[model samples]
Target: MNTTSQPSTADRAFNLSTWLVDRHVEEGRGDVVAIRCGGESHTYRDVLDHVERVATGLRAIGVRSEERVAMVMLDSVEFIATFLGALRIGAIPLLTNPLLPGRDLGVIIADSRARVLVISHERAASLDDIRAGASEIEHVITSDGWADFTASDEDGAAYDTWIDSPGFWLCTSGTTGMPKLAMHTHGDVKATFDTYATQVLGITANDRCFSVGPMFHAYGLGNSLTFPFAAGASTILEPTRPPTPQLVADIVTTEKPTLFFCIPTFLAALTNSDLPDDTFASVRYGVSAAESLPAETFTRFLERFGVTILDGIGSTEMLHIFVSNTPDAHRPGTTGRAVPGYEARVVDPDGNDVADDEPGQLVMRGESSASGYWCRSAQSRATFEGEWTRTGDLYTRSADGFLTYLGRSDDMLRVGGEWVSPAEVEGTLIEHASVLEAAVVGERDSSDIVRPIAFVIAAPGATVDDEELTAWCRDRLAGYKRPKRYEIVTELPKTATGKIQRYKLRR
Candidate 1:
């Protein structure tokens, strides 16, 4: 990672949107590019304009500092503008996946108690049936105006003159229970860019950052949006799901992005797909997070694209990644050393620190740790032991402080009362020649005995029967830990942020 410090003047005040405004005026190089469908390009100035109008419209509609604003929209330019606009006026934006079932969305809306709801045009039309989904929401805004607003601005509500303090509220993708909104002050996001962009990414005015992840997640919000703006760089906004290899390759060819951020699955798909030779030629850095990077994915990415996929571990509560591996320091399977100013440790269930090379719950303490979660005092309190956040995910620390991700606390299975990490099983399974991707979940049998059921996604043009894959696991894993059954699948379900939703498989 680049650690060169550039001199910067301390702002007497800080706001997330103001960062973009400052860049648009003084440092924006104008050559930075982001590509969307049909290869549409957006300049820094254009993005600034959109954010300004959205902020103005929101202010006119009564949004203010610390107010909760719920957003249910796809990946689009409007999503970015509305999100930043909410932050501009100090309104906390709570983002949820638009694809969530109506019942789930209703539960989230009710739990968040958002004062305002912003929906994309397409989403608005589809959600008409659930009009009163958020009873607490007083104002409703849409990309294509549904009520009194229009896509085109008419009221000369001066947006540039409106000023306010900035704050944000976002939900954590909890493995269980309803998601909780994490409270963040205005300075939180700005501080994120300072640490990640200036210190880690080494972003520059000329760099074009391409984010293939959802902006609703912290990875997309900070790494893709806020960090790039901090460096006066540009971003391409695509209002869609994971860009197919053809579309991603096309975007790369058209935009010539300098920095790319995605997860291992997408990277694997890109490497396996029929992308053109020069598709990733201009990229200087590539980052992978949200899930552990498979060793094979790392090797394929480097061999095919000539760009090292720097993997990291981060949580929504921290705002962005706290630990990462750079190209030079990267050990393919490890999550790498902790970022500067952050400390991490592996602790047993009793909260005692464990020795190196031993697996335990990962705990972290850092400047970027969130203040608290909204309305969920009990859950929030459980997250900390003093100031250290108990990351429910399990991990192993090496002698050099490199962290290797295990599975979630809930996902870890027990065989004869002994803990069995699914990640260890899946990693070993994927190492088999016939396997491409694998997920393991506990299956209960007639005797109330829980054993692992492996779901394997085989490599294209490769054939592996379920019985054969089960035997392969038997050879690699311990007798008690080996999969009791195997199921072949085309693909596994994942969250918008690319995390495998193992709970979905449990059902």
Candidate 2:
């Protein structure tokens, strides 16, 4: 708990994965559980053992610190070991969602230019068709079902050759085009942990944490993996897809976690479940990120679970949460305030600061911001303007500094010279009794003009027509802000990390 005396590692540059190992040594938590995956548990000491073996194995396969290593596996102990092991020797570990289809995976593979691939046996077969044409990849390390491969003499030895540089590469969600790989230095990732975990989450050794988010994403990587590990806290890591309320309920019931991190959609689903009282009795703090959390879900989370849902805004570029609302300062719908060592501002189209209540593009410059995109000269130039990273999110800052997310900059709609935020319309629509979830997009009108159209997902067993929904929006929103049309569907499209894919709806 006494973080005051220890000198900051901020200036002492290091790779993210190796710094984690240093923390484990300093904290003397080698015997503590570091990862709990699919009912299997591994201690910090166990993680260290794997790191040595994998680092040696990778070296035996001719992988160097500057070399690229890609992993396509479910969230499990092996995944963590392989990732961190690559880091131990300064190898750049490129992580991607294993559930991605062949076409998407092929694009990422080409983009990453990875020479080595670490994947599970089950997912390995799916690459049979793709591997025929993949000449760049040399070694294919399988976790399961490959029993014939012989271990090298250096398999369990340490790889003493270490280079000091960034540790990983992650492809961004290319909603606009092919995804660009974001280069997160080991130092950047560690900075996120120090700022958010120590300064924002205020975690301690006794806190039991659990993350439903996928580890490949920034949120899960920092908070679920790095933060908890650095703080000496234990986390439950289950490998699953679209974790439903039923699955979450089971995890909460059995794990008895104190802190829970999830997205808004998953939280809404949990609140809608018929779970018994005290189902989340052990949970004292709940954190939501990856997507905007509706006020309705926040209220329901508190009312039913008796724990405040602290919503924060984070991105892959920022490494993790740079703005957060902790338990002490619970702003129901806002994205809270910026973290220490960081500054944020809302800017208009011309790059001038906007008024307190005016919505503008959210621009931030900080220590934890990414250096730049990998290999994309044009993107790096556009995204990195000096030290600032122009976050594409649109937001309005209140007088008290709480950030209200309007939507993504590309998500804003302009119709008849009036600008509108999809979040504002979606927020109003979800407040209606019949709507469960809502997404708003700009559609072409009969005049070939652009206008806001809302897609509504009705609550279970509730049947309300589009006419009624449009009227409801009209009563709650301004004439220009009201939805011109409505599309009723069972659910909205979402990314693997649970963020709404608004671009998909636009198509």
lDDT of each: 0.75, 0.79
Best candidate, lDDT-wise?
2
lDDT over C-alpha atoms for residue 434 of model 1? 73
Best by TM-score: 2
lDDT of 2 at 482: 87
Report the C-alpha lDDT of model 1 over 295-388, residue by residue, as the tens digit.
7788878888888788888888887888888756889888888877678989998989999988899998876677778777887898855779
After superposition, which runs of candidate 2 have C-alpha atoms over 4 Å from their true positions?
1-15, 22-27, 132-134, 145-151, 155-164
Count of steric clashes across candidates, in order: 3, 1
Per-residue lDDT tens digits for candidate 2, residues 79-155, read 78788878877788898878876557766776777888888666776586445444577788888732223244565
What are the TM-scores, per candidate, against the unseen true structure?
A: 0.89, 0.93
Q: How far does residue 449 in candidate 1 sit from its true spot (Å)?
A: 3.2
